[model samples]
Target: MSEQTFFATAPAGVELLLAAELVELGAATAQAARGGILFRGPLELGYRACLWSRTASRVLLPLAEFPAADAEALYAGIHDLPWENHLAPDGTLSIEFNGSGPGIDHSHYGAQRVKDAIVDRFRARCGERPSIDSRQPDLRIHAHWRNGQVTVSLDLSGDSLHRRGYREATVTAPLKETLAAALLLKAGWPAIAAAGGPLIDPLCGSGTLIIEAAWMAGDHAPGLLRSHWGFSGWLGHVPALWNRLLAEADERCAVGQSRIPPLFASDHDSKAVRATLINTGRAGVADRVRVERREWATVKPPPGPPGLLIANPPYGERMGETDDVSALYIQLGERLKSHFGGWRAALFTGAPELGKRMGLRAHKTNVFYNGPLECRLLQFRVEPEFFVDRDAADRHARAAALNRAISDGADGFINRLRKNLRHLGRWAEREGVSCYRIYDADLPEYAVAIDRYEQWLHVQEYAPPSSIDPARAQQRLEQVIAVLPAVLELPPDQVVLKVRQRQKGASQYQKQAEQGRFHEVHEGPARLLVNFTDYLDTGLFLDHRLTRQLLREQATGRRFLNLFGYTGTATVHAALGGATSTTTVDLSATYLDWARRNLELNGIHGSQHQLIRADCRQWLTRTLDRYDLIFLDPPTFSNSRQLTESFDIQRDQVELLRQTLRLLAPGGVLIFSTNHRKFRLEVAALADIHLEDWSRRTLPPDFARDPKIHRCWRITQS
Candidate 1:
């Protein structure tokens, strides 16, 4: 057979790894390109590449590459290809377009033209044409144009390989599958596992790394378990050859009872352990891996010598968004240098500044894209002679840093951990709360987060050690957690540690309650009813307690308007606090009902209370009604099916907050609140109103976490 070429694309940064995978999979020869790998091989080799290649995001069989300076030329070039060889007359095909090029302004138009060309070509010859199925088509085609050259290829993987189909549930932050495989491959796990070191990921986190490592180390193909392969639907697909290829894979993957790996994984959260088990099973590697529910500090490496430890820790980036990332990173570095020795390690993180807190040096580092965020996969080597360094210092320093983080300095080491804790400790002690949580719960590298919901603080406990070496990341979390209670003054019962979870069912526990319904029953709180049953958030925001109270004190006998009313907790507060009348407007009927209940529960009655269901943004445009006071607090982001469209606070805050201004009566106050941590109020933009930020002073005694939980702006347009 003549030499045949194929293109394999990956989420940026894996092009080289995909090329490497192709070369090992028996490609005639492979070369790395901009966003994909190009190789020449036989039909069986192509099947094997699609079956076993873990690093490649999608495999594409190019049909043609030509120049199209304009849309007409682009259409003609794609229409001229042999679409019949790839798609059957009765088959369904879909098209996708990528890359920026001149003359082609719209990508959807490009895809449509190609689709039209293919369907027209088939119709011209057979008098009938294949159907178009964008959702799950028999064929997925990619159109790429760079400069004046256009390359069209068959999208051999219908969906992304990241859809491994094993995730039973995903928590706030779960690492993408493709990124996980790339991180492991970059960590040199294949070489280390193949050379005899036990492979373990103590912070397994949704089992992405554990499963990826198992497949690579076991020489098991990732795409094997997939019931469907893109090429299987192609016109030239050979059933006999496909079955034979699968049989060979089964033979190769049939591990002997003794030759299997000693993979160990642990997390303080039981839920994470369960999630890991289900994901592993879905990936077909459950029986080969042992998972445990244990804290990072207490996680014991399997009896064998330290091998390869890989972890994707929270960088306070994607999964976590607290400014305390520096402190967490410092603790992680101290733990690795103290606990892990004689081990090769790799960690993926987004916060570059926190890397300085690791204290130890990284040997090799590479950048990879994790979704829209740019992340770093850093590798470090540790010997058995490693000893305690930072953790050996003062107990108060460690505790304070862990419990409370400081955000003052911006120097070498950035000191995100020590500094945060010192300042946090001062605030906690001053406020008399024995236990307070300080953390970086958001940003780019945040692949995991510690949710302090319901007065319960959950820690990811991965990044602290990842700063140095992942060989001992969990050990560090365990050690730090052992002393955490002493600093936070939190009892054993109050502490609820959540491990990394993946795959959550809609039928399972509801993340939030109905938009306007007040179903969240209050377990505690003397002033107002607190509920999370009807919304994504429980009604009472501990951080905004003072602000809510402030509204009630000033609401006496006044008519108040609550825009984006949520649970109408403020209305209930105003009613109880002596407001004469309360009118609430929101987009969700579910929330409107909740607000009504909150008012009813507080002993406030009838005619004085009004609940109007409307998108506060659009409804406010025509209304002339005004109130003595207005309370506005909209969500930071939402994809509510009830609404006609989605809303993002990052882009819509200033405009939304400005909308609330029109509803406030002269001399009446508009108490606006936004949980977006980075909100800056755009004070100059609102020239007609006077704005005063009450975030720091409004933090109440019972809620002693970070002061930036919600920025409160008292707006009055005189």
Candidate 2:
């Protein structure tokens, strides 16, 4: 095969790495450019790149480069290429037109001109032209034009190299195969594997990184599992030479398979673990990769020399807090230092600042891109000296001092917390409640709410006023965190910290974390699931203890309807109250699922119980069914895009109650509630209904400190 110049395209920030890979693949000279690497090498080298170069998006063999100053010039340049030598007139073709210059300002028009030129040339000679197939074409052509210079190339790697044909299943946010390979390479996995060291990814989601690492370690070509390649249909492909390369790769794979080292992967999610198994099996590395469903904190190195620890941990996109995620990183770093000494670890995170919260200095940091999100690959060697307690490390003396710095009002805050916890604890125990708030801005200086769910402490720091110094607020917060463990006799890990900003409308309903760890807690006579780290509020509303209790008392022998149900904690109370039939409505699928789980937990089921995921306002307006008892606890200011119209308690409550009242059975009662501190009822507007303010009556002892926690009202037909 003759020498040819080839280009391997990679994602931005990876061009230099891809160029290095090409140079290692026998390229005479490899030059890194913006989107790809340009190299002069044997034709087989391009084929090998498609087979083994992991960071490349596509391997292109440029057929021609010319000046295409205009649409007609582009047509002539594309027409002048010997299309007959690469693609048959009867074969289908696809063009990937990129860049623009001079008259070729749009990709679509440039592509159209190129297409017309190819077919027109073919039609003039062969009497027929190849058709275009964009999805899966018989031939794939790449056109790149910049500053009036156009380069037409044959795409030897049809689909992106990221599609390794192994990910038949995936969990949310699974890393692309090429990016995963890049992560592993940047982490020095090749060197580690060469030394027969083990590898582990604690937060392995869908096994992309683990499987890619296994393949790289076992000398298996990534394309070996792929059945299709751009060159498979290209007329320029040399069948004999391709087969020889495949045979060599196969033999090397067999040899490397025998010497494969220990590889392990785990995820907290069972679904992800199952997916990892399925994907690894499909990738032909199931036997070599051991997968388990386990939490990241509990993961220990396998019984072997320490190798590498890497993870694509959740970035709190679905649900998480800076404090929660920061604590997680700290835990990860601590575990690595204590348990996996001498091992190397790489963490790929979009928030590099969070990585700093791990408390371990990074030996090296490499910038990479996960699509549009700029990410960093932080490398750490888990040396004992590096793992020493931050307080003991002299360089961190300031942080330690900050922790010790008790702000002027911190003592008062701690005192208020202790008093509240004692009072709430006694009340909760007497009431058989396992979850309730202990503090809610009891001291003005420490603007936070503290809740206890069994053994876990969920702390929500209220966004302090801008009038306060941020440094002072953070210092006070650190003091509270430092004091909590000792005051509550809980481990630091059990203390889940979150910052609570005043959220409007549906933003409060959005998840803060996707940990999926649920704790079963007792609320009145109901068994409910509450997540401390995964959401803004626990599944159960502690302040509504009395409200739900009131629901239980009134729901007996009556039909109950829960609007804006919110995990159905109130519905659960009503169900256990012997309601003949119950219907729960909410807009969130996640909450509805949680509601079902709440019902299932308490042995509530059958046709008498219904869970409808719909906008409560819309459901109320359309439902012909009437109920004897109703709970209308709407958000303070809801503006969900999923709803037909936005809802504001102050502005829309009249219409909301008007629609809800129509669904109320005659002689039945409706319990309306809101957390809007300044909410005012339009008594004159709802003159048709008899209303009584029950806000004080439903206030729980634990929430007496904050009398304005929630306002409640009882409405009945006149």
Candidate 3:
């Protein structure tokens, strides 16, 4: 067979890696291009790439190139290709069209045109047309249209090379096999493995990293486990050559396995560990790879010379809050420094800023893409000289700098804060409200909310808008911080600072810090726990002070239920109000435990004052219990892993209300509240329920400045 031009596609920032891999697999010349690599190779080289190249997403064999300025031109160019040489009249086909151009703005329309052209050509010449079989096509065609130029090719690797056919069980957000290989190659794992060094993944999710490492160390072709390929049904496929390569790969794998060094993997999640074990077995590396369920803090290095220690830790994308994720990275860095000394470490994170919290300085950093999220691979030489305590250093530097005299520009902020303290302070003391907002962006220049919890202050800076210069924002924030110690008559250590931004999904419920610090605060005959430095909110919602008081005022001898209970402050109030029974339903185990503590703190306990950990929506549907009073305050949006589908307050409000009402006994009252500012009550939909807008009536004096802080409704069956 003659030489052919092939394009090997890869993820963004991996073109050079893919190019090197193609060259190693026998390409005569490989040049890196955007999103892929261009190579010139014989037909056998393309086949070899399909079977050996670990980084390439797909290997395409170009058949023709032409001008495709319009749909008709595209169809004509596709029709002119010798379809008879590729697919028979009765064979199945699929088209993957990319890079839209003039009159081809949509990929689907362009692909339809290509498919039509091919089918029309086959019908005109052979009296029958190939059928479209997207899942498993006999012939998969790829068409690229750019700048009125078209290049059509045969996709020799179907279903993406990343799908190596070994991952039968998987946890959420497992790393792609090809991307994992790129990470290993970038870390020079092959060299380490060849030198008889061991590799360990402490947070291995489904074992993609370790499996890929084992494959590279064992000289096993990535495609050896794959049972099918795009070239299987291609008319030009040389089965004899492919068989010879497969046999050679098998022999090499056998020899490579004998010399494979110690490989180990583990995860704190048992499901993930089980998945890694199952996947390793399926990949034929079960004996070579040791899998275990171990926490990052407890992970020990295998007994061998220090090799590569890599991990893809959580980075607040799908799970964990910023502070908690930062702590995880900090813990990982500490573990690496203490236990894995003299090892090569690579940590991949979507939020590159979090990598700074790891303390150990990276000698090298590489950019890679995990799907659409841009991520960084920070490579470190785990030696004592490379370690730096960044968190402690930052705190010391900040404390030293901020301890100086307050800035003159902060006078306006200081005056306003003092005035708020004078007014809200007196009201808080009179009403026995210990946790209340002292200043809520009272001055536009500050853009922060200062809440007083007993003697400690929690200052949350609202994320500044894009229009404001970041440096300017930082300066204003520092001025506020500098002035707070003087104006509040409290030491700087009493203040905890956090940046508050709009949260999506279930991030608001995640733990910001694992400080496990809780302080008791009083409000109208109830004592609740609040943490100044551990969470976005201090477990207690100050705006709902009046709402909880109302629940307490009306809860005499009534059975109560709290939905989306969050810390169960309302339940605690109701239980103290002498309710006959109380049950709190929330999805978070952490919050549920906190609720249990709140109940015990108030000396309210028993199965009757129950704390249930479950998705409230699903629980509401399944429970047969009834209640005389219900408090329902759900997050604006929740896409928790526990939920089959996400909940939108605006979209699902009516349905949620109806479900809660089902549990409400006759003449029972339901208090539905949400912090969603723009929430509109769908009164017409709830015609059967007697609903009253209690938003104004429930607002406490402390929260009056922000009328839209929350919305409340008193609901009952008509």
Candidate 4:
């Protein structure tokens, strides 16, 4: 047995930073390499690396390197290696193959060849082979093949180092553990925390930044939380030394004084506060970090000489297809400019629109790619009178930089949604089939509207912090939403309040649509009762605007059917679209009544629409009406008895398709649709009917990025 060299991986762009960290932790001449630093040392150094190095992803020990021209050569090279040296009879192993040559074009196939070589080597000698555990493999064999040369090494990190095992709970947009450490490193929070200042994150999504600060400030090692390290099962392992190192790291930490220096996190969400609290506790930093639920307006700048005020705010685009949070960002800048004077802050965001919303020029911006998105961390120097510059050149330079860096990996929630929304929106528009955007673009909300298609990005919405003064935050949210269009230059008619609807008594004849050009609007064939003012919105949902239009085109001379027909907009469109008769179904009594009123307002008689008050799916099964053209749009996932029957588009789509297909007449179409964001159709299973995907073709210009807001399939027997 011999002690050899190893390389621990760090994320890209942070290799030099990690190298510096390794050298500072007392490693011998750490040289910065590709993924991480390369350092030659004893067993003690590897243990120290696990305990002390905060930036390293995983450490790997290279067992052998051989030149192979083909698959047979690769197998022979791996088969000859001593596989039992690293593993006992009970040891389990997993293999990861990274290929870059034509000899092994398929990664899985290459990995299989390597696995066969290893098992053959073991079985020929000992008549037994190791088990494979993809999740918790004791010895992970990592193979890197470049230009027909294969290098196989045992991964020392049993699992990804990002699995800190400390985050108890997380809200939407939780930062990866490795990424959190890197962002803090870039922001230079360690030096500031050590120099006697509180480490603060105003929009701490999952307490990652604050916990990282506490760990750094207290001199705590991150690897202490994880019980298993890849080196622990290796040759010449030192359990005593590892425990001692952990103990020493623990002894070295001290509680940060509340007044001297502290770690603080704030957000305007209550659920996020709970998540942060749980996360901090799991991280063993709950006592050290203080979290608050606060709106930006209520938040005070750091006390005691104005320390760092780093915020990863909502840019309104990354996580979902919505950019309505522009006003929130602009308001954030106003707050920081007025309240957080004499403070140095770093704003990590992926959206350039957010920087413009701040209405303040950034001092420095760093370009970093968060996956596919090219994001930036904009630095700002705030003083008593925040930068009131006098130049066009600076503005032009800033604009150019902002345009160049359109993506962000802020680890904070705000920009994630902004980026997602932008990507989804752009995708839909390019396909030229937009109906209505499913974004909550209330300016104050910093959203357009989120659709099922946009939900494919899985953008998370933060549960508001517990400490937010609801009255103040709500008022601020409304004000920001109301004033957003002035700067955006979008028509008020184009911008609708996405409000929740509730039922009312018969005596309460609520004022819905009144006299104005807005009072009555027409969509080709159907007349709509449009109300742009009062409350968050009117009866019409623009996302379904195109769906309604499609229903109108398919309604001519057929017995039209509308299920889950909220307010009967589709029904009215069907009747006016020249349908012989329309049947509408819903569980809401008020909505059914409202639907009737809407038709009456448009001079279309209620007799034309047979309004049935019952659960749509239940009504479908019980009724004997075989319609020529049926519009069956079910919720992505609904548990309510109204349409429930455990509706899931991805899982039950085939069954529902079969059901809808039964209702269509020969040569007639059944438009089967579901708004489930992640719904994927199995075209082969539904081969009985001809399927035409009309999602992109039916979209409106505003909601073009995520065309699958809900997939519209026209199925008819050819």
Q: Which candidate is the best by TM-score?
A: 3
Better of 1 and 3 by lDDT: 3
User: What TM-score, computed on C-alpha atoms, does each candidate reach?
Assistant: 0.57, 0.70, 0.72, 0.59
The residue-by-residue lDDT of candidate 2 on 1-718, one tens digit each, is 6789888889877887787888888987988876888998787898899988988998988889998777788888888878888788899999889787766778997788889999999998789999999977878998888888888998899998899899999887889999999999989999999898999998888999999999999989998888778988888888898899899989999998976789999988788899999999998999999999888899998886779999988865422322356667878977887788799999999878667657688889999989899999999988865554543443354344434544544667667777877877887788787777888887778888888887778899999998999999998888777777667766456688999898887888888976777778787678888887677887878888899999999999999999989899999999999999999999899999999999999999999999998888778767899999999999888778898777889998899999999999989999999999998899999998899999999998878878898999999999
Model 2: lowest-lDDT 10 consecutive positions: 316-325
**Pick by TM-score: 2 or 3, better one:** 3
CA lDDT for candidate 3:
0.87
Q: Per-candidate RMSD vs. true structure?
A: 14.5, 7.2, 9.3, 16.6
- What does candidate 4's lDDT look like per residue over 45-157, in tens digits? 77777776777888777778889988889999999987777777567778899885656788899899899998888888888888787877767889988876788988776
Query: lDDT of all predictions, in order shown?
Result: 0.68, 0.85, 0.87, 0.66
lDDT of 4 at 582: 85
Clash count for candidate 2 is 5
**CA displacement after TM-score superposition, residue 221 of candidate 1 (Å):** 1.0
Candidates, ranked, lDDT: 3, 2, 1, 4
Candidate 2: Cα lDDT at 517: 71
Q: Write candidate 3's Cα lDDT for 481-500 as tens digits.
A: 87775677654556789999
Ranking of candidates on TM-score, top first: 3, 2, 4, 1
